[model samples]
Target: MAQLAQSITPVDAVVSRMRALDATLPERDGVAVFNRVYLAVTEEVDRHLDAGAFPDPEAAITLDVRFAERYLRVAEQGCPPACWRPLLQFRRHPGVRPLQFALAGINAHIGHDLALAVVDACRTLGCEPADLEDEFDRVGDLLISMEERIREDLMPGPDLLQIADPLTHLLGSWSLERARDATWSAARALWALRGLPDLAEEFCDRLDAAVGFAGRMLLTPLPD
Candidate 1:
């Protein structure tokens, strides 16, 4: 295990962990639903990296690894942040649709974890968020595409798109594009406050709680 860990790239290792989760988790499990979506996004990003798509593949790799590690850490831990609590708590709730599960996970990761991961990658790479702008935007673009695909694949058909449908409201409430923009701002804010550990920690805590609240809303139960 030690030798294998040393040889494996961070992205590869994270992808492996996600795959393991996919294999073990049941198809209807909420976390598994999100895991499947995330695994696809990660693989797509990996392919981009291999194709030399990013202007700074090293920085992109570092950012991607750090970003994935945040999610994996919360998943492996006994206690995760508020942003992850909803999904973990409702992983098997029958009323929550698969689309809800997937989007809630995206909300938490993009709204909360992504910002912190940006700061983490910055510290590791010894560069500012601006230095990672190209890689960040590229990754964000991929995520946007993933989000679009998720909606298409998971969203109910036109028959279910009535004005009274709860899913319609839920979908309208959260926007990945907006979340991506906010995450960039949050990342820059976090980088600025890096010198003040207390303030930074407080900011993160608030962000986590806020994102968690949003996740909880996204996972709202609907009638069968």
Candidate 2:
């Protein structure tokens, strides 16, 4: 269960707290911005999660992106963005910038996956499909903003060991296989949803399942 600590709701308290964290930063602005932004966003998210509003699928899906963006941004370069890493690793360079951009993209990917899970669960509801589509568009806009923001902070193009390999023999083993696997799993899950009316009840389960699959991947072997 990946601890799932990121926010799924975008609330005012989150923004306010993020701003406050940003305000308290000392001089020397290399990775401090990452630290401040991560704290502010995480605080904003944690503060909004209540029994009624947060645990619900709608709110959690939204805030997860906010949390992921914060984590990706603050993760300091050249490491898995764990809790304990030296501050000195966050060196500025033309290289290794794409890794940051790609990590930011991972946040968007997680949000997108969550949204799909929600929609799958809500397919039988009275809510029109258009509402889901509109919500997706809104999320897409946020993703765009994150992309632009990351681009501002990171250089474009591939670098670093963790960089996405688009032009390598690993594409088939790494990227395409994962896509195919996800597609097959999705088809099977959709098949399970057929002839079911209590879809709303199943959304969280499916969402969690999908998230768990990713969590397993993150736990796999990595270079030292």
Candidate 3:
């Protein structure tokens, strides 16, 4: 337990792991698409930590590492939560746009994994979600800031027919702000349910399935 805690406690090690993923994963793969987005966020968090932006840097590191580890674990184990299954299943579909892949991955991570990550951090630190609110909001803000860039960088070019693209409409339907807000609520609810283990597990499972449904929608393969 001590070694496991130590492994994920350092921001540098987490960033290194992400960089390694970026190096190894194929560019067009769905997991790779999400990894790039997540890697950028992790790198930004590292910068913020260096600049003393987080009031509780250790808590922040714990949350970030714990959150990322969930995703990495899924990749290694091939036993992802419901929220991530769609993205993984559709990763290689040529019809799924890069933008769709990125958004679906974000949906799974933010919608499902993030709530559980909050609970994981609280358990690790022997604290509560309220204690990590500042860090949560800060990390969320970084993710929100990156959403625009993700679209701009990944979206199909503005060719004549692309103006009326279905991907454009699909992308518009989901908002990072909404996802972040929902995650906060889910985190708080999960924390409240911590005393009731069975209930909390059921809630988490439901959340995972709901997020997976959304991911499936996001990955609706559009004709090229």
lDDT of 2 by residue, 5-91 (tens): 444444544555446544665433434434443444344334544333233435344434443444444432333322212222332
What's the residue-level lDDT of 124 in candidate 3?
Answer: 94
Write down the TM-score of every candidate.
0.93, 0.35, 0.93
The regions of model 1 sitting more than 4 angstroms off are 1-8, 159-164
Separate clash counts for every candidate: 0, 8, 0
Show the colliding residue pairs in model 2. Answer: 7-63, 7-64, 8-60, 8-63, 8-64, 9-63, 14-44, 18-40
Taking the tens digit of each residue's C-alpha lDDT, what string does model 1 give over 134-175? 888999999897787898899888877673388878778899
Q: Which is better, 1 or 2, measured by lDDT? A: 1
Once fitted onto the true fold, the runs of candidate 3 whose alpha carbons sit more than 4 angstroms away are 1-9, 160-164
